[model samples]
Target: MLFIQRFVEFAHAFPEAPAIVDASSELSYGELYKQAQRLVEVIESTSSGSMIGVLMEKSVDYITSVLAIHLSGRTVVSLDRNYPVERLRQMVTSIDLSLCLLNEQEYDELNVMLDQGIRSLRIDKPTAPSADNDSVEIKPETLEEIPAYVVFTSGTTGQPKPVMVPYRSLSTLIDWMLKAPGRAGTTLLYAAQGFDVSFQEIYSALCYGDRLLVITDEQKKDMHELTREMVSAAVTRLFLPTSMLIPFVTFNLHDSQVLDDLQEVICAGEQLKINPVVRQWFKAHPQCQLINHYGPAETHVVMEHRLSSEPEDWPDLPPIGKITQASTAFLLDDHLQPVLQGNIGQLYIAGRSLALGYYGMSAQTAEKFVTHPQTYERMYNTGDICVLNEQALFEYKGRRDRQYKIRGYRVELKEIEIVVADSELVEDCLVVARQFGRTTTLVLYFTAQDRDQDLSMRLHTHLTTRLPDYMLPSFYKKISAIPLTPNGKVDLQKLPEVGGLRSLISTSYVEPHGELETTVCELAACCFGLDRLGANDNFMDVGANSITLISLLAELRYVLAYDFRQTDLFEYPTPRLLCATYQRSLDTTQQGAPTVVPASSRKQRLIAIQRFQEKKGG
Candidate 1:
């Protein structure tokens, strides 16, 4: 009722307030509510209780469509824009959708086969009404069915797994959020419509008829542009991943000025690798709240909230946070027995917010969503490895399996390695995550015979560009050989942990020149928290390249205001020389000379990385 009532509350109270905003458009709560109502009218004409597939880029249109589907009594099934067309087809059939909602672009792209008799509502300019009268009051299909959404998880499996979220649980969550009692004002950042975490912004803002700052999908990925919005907007609450949240720390860590208006910083997705960001916020303003939320997609929203001021007692309530008031966490051993505190175990979450189950896979759903033998309540098995403390708060360890988080982005390591295997430069590759000094960074080791690539920079840059910024491996290492076990699988544990970066980047890179270059070189060296940085020293061995590295780069780029790629550092290995080369490149491009973009350089460097990968077992 609370989630359903949220729309009505916002419509009555803040009709004129902006509910969503993208680059060139703004939709007020009133308009959004109206559109949803119209959509409801359209849905009653179709099969009742059918799932409405919401597919499109993140926008006010996409957001409004989802609420409309929910209001229409139809469950919403979100289709991710990032995935391929073939994947959409496979997932659609798996869910057995009755109706699919589409904007023109998505309709053509997906090209859903007409054989299944799936109904679609084409969003076009409205014409005169049909004989089906407007007086007909339509009841919502979900009134009996109860499902509000079906979300797909991005995991190691090639096929996307659908998780059903019901209205009762959603209502429970939205009600609790509205009652969470905060200051008079709260603002939300609308990052993406499909991702469940985006709700922290939407419902949080809708709670008090507060403003929702909707960044377009393009702007969300484009941090340079996003920075402008962050400083300029009159914002208070920011919900972001640790990697995305790192920028604020580097820029504001030393500054005494509190975000002035910024109040609560809710971090979810991946664990917080860097502390300085939240530490600085709390230091600047004692009242500022920094909440680290950890839970799986099954939990409707985050069931934990950990707030700290000045990081008291260090590592106490570190890593991740505790369960929320309405939620319960479990630390289950290998046999599913409850584990003691500090002993690593698989985390299971149980609460009103627990999702219904996997949409189609009943067996898989039964395996994960199990009834706790002791409490007799349903609990979801989270594949994450962590421990439950005495206070009941959960701390994250790593994954139970090979899946890992990089810069707060959930990554299937083998997926990235697959891309490497397909690329020409990689002969053999193994990826491992190394946790040192509270931060877990990724290290890649591979071997090759006749290498022709600058393996480190190419792989780093290639992965960085293709995936979300957080998924980029912080440290890239190419090795002459990878350790193998008797079974011939790469023996990850036996590999050298300290000697990776130099081989990746220092192969043939030269340093840059001049004051800007020199200062950058010095700043990078200092920022690394390194004892010493030499021309040939690799960042892998010295604990370099991370979300922190991206943050540092952003600051430097803002000052430089000149566009540069992370790969640029590969070409100019040393600080001094890299800077000098960057300056020269800028000058050359400015004066009408064709930019001497290095294609061969990227190709060759990738070859070196591939070469090293091939030697993994040889």
Candidate 2:
């Protein structure tokens, strides 16, 4: 009810103000409220429970459906439109969902997955109501008991577990956002709907009567397009996951003035480390405030640290500043006792911001949510290892569980193992994260008598259907058997190094032939720190970080005299693929005009030798 009450207030205060904007449409506060009213009537007539499923993309309709469900005193479960059919079915069956609100496009596929008794309504194809209806009347006390939304996160059992968040918790975040600096103006809702950070973008903008700009999945994947959309929309407030933010700030928007109007940029979802590239960006853009937000899905953004001025000294990782007024965090050891200051301990969160616990998993709920020994308050053990610095700020160490972040996505090693073990070619599987410089690659070690090449292809094909791209292991190694410790457990420390395994990229070598191909290949080899590079080798596998990629792109831009997007590196990872793409672009440009080489013969020789090093005889 608090969510609805705030919407009603916003509608009354700024009825004509734009509330949500997507590529195709825009909805003002008044229009949004009217749509929600109609949707609430439909939901009340069809659903009897408090939880409803919302299956739609990031658009105005999705925002309308969420508000309608909240106004109807029901919790909204956001079902991602991009989820595989099997994954979607699992989520639908996991909860006691009786009604699902979907758009016309997704209704058909999702309809087949729902039970016969469960109802599915397409918001886009809504039936006309007999008459205009008033808003649902709910007391403030009743609103306190209803959950605002439910989000699912990776579980240890290789399945996603749901965490129900109450309305008050959401309201607390909105209230804080309203008072926070640079709260006004358009905020970009760039995160996927399934992520809790997306909720911050949605509710904070609507509650404060600020414009909320939405980007499609395609735009989110292409940093160039997303930057164009942000600039075109005059976006001021931005929220991005650390993974995306790194590339955007370091490469895509490196020298662009498109985001000069940005007032506040919040980075969350993964750990925020103050690397050289990130520090350089902060120094370049001092007008905007850079905030590092830290919290789990259970407690949405309970801690915030801001970097306003250029940093004189760099730290390994940014501090997760003071806790919010709505929550309290403790550093406890394995025995649940408070650890001494500066010592690493498991983080425990307590207070109103805590979630309602895992849905339908009472045993897991009891194990994770425990009563504080001293305060007699309910607390959720965050399995993250942390320590309190001398400045009294919480500093993140690492996770205690087998879960880690891949491109800002929370991935459980067991989850990958579960999927891999389902393959017929795999006898047993052990997945681990391997770090080389700044890049982290997931490596899968398995027992298979077949050749490594055969098993790798087979496992990759099989897992592609079951898992998302980020969750896929980058390296696959076939071992006779998993190394076991004296205690008969898998010896993770003794697992084969990633370098010893076959590179996931194509192994067959392809030599560059044409002058253009040769030039591009030489530049790529320089960026990767290799003497002789093959066309089939991947830039990432050869030690190309974000910084190196940016430098490579800059060199290519000057030599080719053609603008290139940062996303090109991801789409065409190998030198062979990139050379082909560049040739195609050149062909298109030269179709109507005479061909002219951008670089002179001597200039090309100098560019090729920029980073080339001569090999010495051993």
Candidate 3:
């Protein structure tokens, strides 16, 4: 059966079920179904084969309008509400939007300056239906020219790349993977609607006999609130960014009782990296299924799937796991020769999961998505570096481009965090890189501050065993808190920004004086890849990130024989501050240099140290 028919069937079967709920507003399945058809009538009333833009959040209106566009025999382009006006305008102009699903607020904000005309929809009382279903006459066309939706992604070249998806693969995904179970219905947790992954996830979830829990971005961002809802609603099936699961589990998600009926936690896009905290938690709850998936937006669903039990073979390795049964994977070096088993290379996926091609980008579409070298069929150059092991599983390495490279080394930021998280000292940590023109540095940030001396020593002792020497960061700047973006991801931009000469010290940080402060500042400058070293500044507000902190810590310790812990760095965030503390300790010993240590009296020192330690422990 066709994909549209599948969507329509689910609507008919569960017309009375609740489809979408957020805040106080609630829309039943039947009510949403009619509202969607009303939008369809409004759409087909104008142009039969035109593309309509859905500029809404991940709510009932958004999900309903998607099928409405398909029902209207028109293409739909999912648009982000967070995008800047200029970028939104560019997308609207590019797609030649015939109709736009907008609230009254959006219409007031957008209608005046639109270059290409659009029919705005402010569904007054949203129940008011337009009596016109005669406009939609379904046409059968399997030609590659047909476009289901156009999704835009940020490309390396600083331009928006649209991946035009066809109904064939979209339908195949629903028919194959999105299955209905007896007595238990899946709740489709909607996230990333602007991205193609969410589009397919959402489409397939509702199309197959399932109850969709279409969520707003605001709900997902609130981990505590979202988990409460997830538990209350007994959400069995969920889709999310893999990066989120660990932290969400750490913060609010707990207990076997909260998710007793849950069978699958489907995750993708940053899923190859295994977080020890989440892994351990999942291990404790063996019955709850955890599915780690891999595939680009160009590919629908997943080309690869790793069940939780696959870890038996990966005691020393992290793998994205084996490709799906209907898909084929290739790991070829730069010269396109097949790499030896377990040798790293660029990944190329072929067979059913490969996308039709990028929309409006003929050259780019041809370059990356092309015919196989040996066969007549097509393949997509995944750009992700990986290795095909003897077990036939593809393990992810890192990105190939220089933008991903840091300090003349291929750094997998995720690997560093994974290892640190496994240490058990830190509840959570993140590594991020900042580049100032040609110079680059890594920063490491974690939730724990007062890691015991034993914890610090153990962390240092095991660095060589777990990570490669070059991959180890030079500086360690820790913060008591790690700021999160509105979407729950770490906000890298908020990290302290280092400047010339004084860039080594974290921005806004001030230190008690000693000769060691100067030396540590120099090391901080070098770790951050700054041409000049500074003596004063705080780290967090200055933009020193988690990855830079770890990278700098490794460089300083290996290069200089100082025994510093990743935990100590957080307590004393700036180079001047940490170095000053070290210098004072040496002076107290009355052995190293005879320099006068900066002192605010012994009583004040004790109080300061107590406060510092307290801040770090939390």
Candidate 2, residue 43: the lDDT equals 86
Residue-level lDDT tens digits of model 2 in 83-172? 766667767777888898888788778777677867888887747663665455756787775678888777767677888898888887
Descending-lDDT candidate ranking: 2, 1, 3
Off by over 4 Å in 2: 180-183, 312-316, 436-439, 449-453, 499-506, 509-533, 538-562, 565-573, 580-618
CA-lDDT, candidates in order: 0.61, 0.75, 0.59
Leading candidate by TM-score: 2
Candidate 1 residue 57 C-alpha distance from true site, Å: 2.7
Residue-wise C-alpha lDDT for candidate 1, range 1-618, written one tens digit per residue: 546566666576768876655666777778767766776677666568568887777666676777777666667887766654545665677777887776766676656433256777665447336453322233434453367777666444435567777776666666666645444454655445446766556666765666666665555545544545655565677887765664555444434453567777777777654343345447666656777777666785555555653454345236576566577788888777898787889888888778888876788789888988878888898888887667766677767577766644456677667655656677788778765322356666777765665577777666643444444566656677878899987787788754333333335643534445434544454445332345444444355654445554544553454555555555655565565676687787777542333446333423432332233210
TM-score of each candidate?
A: 0.74, 0.87, 0.66
TM-score: model 3 vs. ground truth: 0.66
After the best TM-score superposition of candidate 1, give how far the Cα of residue 276 lies from its true spot, in angstroms: 3.6
Best by lDDT: 2
Which structure is stronger by lDDT: 1 or 2?
2
